[model samples]
Target: MINNLFSAVSAAAAQEHFDELLRRPGLRIERIVSQGQASPTGFWYDQPQGEWVVLLSGSAGLRLAHEPSERVLSPGDFVEIPAHCRHRVEWTDTSAPTVWLAVHFDAV
Candidate 1:
């Protein structure tokens, strides 16, 4: 089967959308769409699995717990977050949908 990642997105969505694309032992892939969504104040994500994510469209602000400043991510930008690394989404573009391709995997 063939599918397009940029299809079926809701531009007027009030909250971020997460779609699971594939899953297998020790690995998972997802398509995330965000529009003006951000992590709650003082909140952070600490996951057991590491994540490698790429910005496909629009832009976003990503902050790591150990970093003093947020990293601005543009289209084609990518990041690898180790397991147990605390991170948060500072913000996403409000004028357009920010598409992200995220892969979560167990550390070897």
Candidate 2:
């Protein structure tokens, strides 16, 4: 069950790619690759589970519903999004693919 995280980068469009790296009871891990894609306008992610994510490469912009300013992320930047927090991806680096590792689990 060994695989490279950067493998299989699609070049067809500016679509984000998500790969489920691991799934177990109460936990899930994913590898996300983004290239100039972002959440749809007026769209927000309200998840029941908390998520911790880190940018492994490239850059990105994130904004929480309650936050007035957007946070730009670079390589090695990480953030914790609590359960029920509304957030969205504002942008990702278009010059290169942005790689992210995310872990989702029950908060309680």
Q: For residues 1-108, what per-residue lDDT tens digits would candidate 1 score against the true structure?
A: 899999998785898999999999999999999999999999999999999999999899999999999999999999999999999999999999999999999987
Q: lDDT tens string, model 2, 52-98? A: 99999889999999999889999999999999999999999988889
lDDT per prediction? 0.96, 0.92
lDDT of candidate 2 at residue 8, scale 0 to 100 = 83
lDDT of 1: 0.96
What is the TM-score (0 to 1) of candidate 1? 0.98
Highest TM-score among the candidates is held by which one?
A: 1
For every candidate, C-alpha RMSD to the true structure in Å: 0.6, 1.3
Worst 10 residues of 2 by lDDT: 6-15
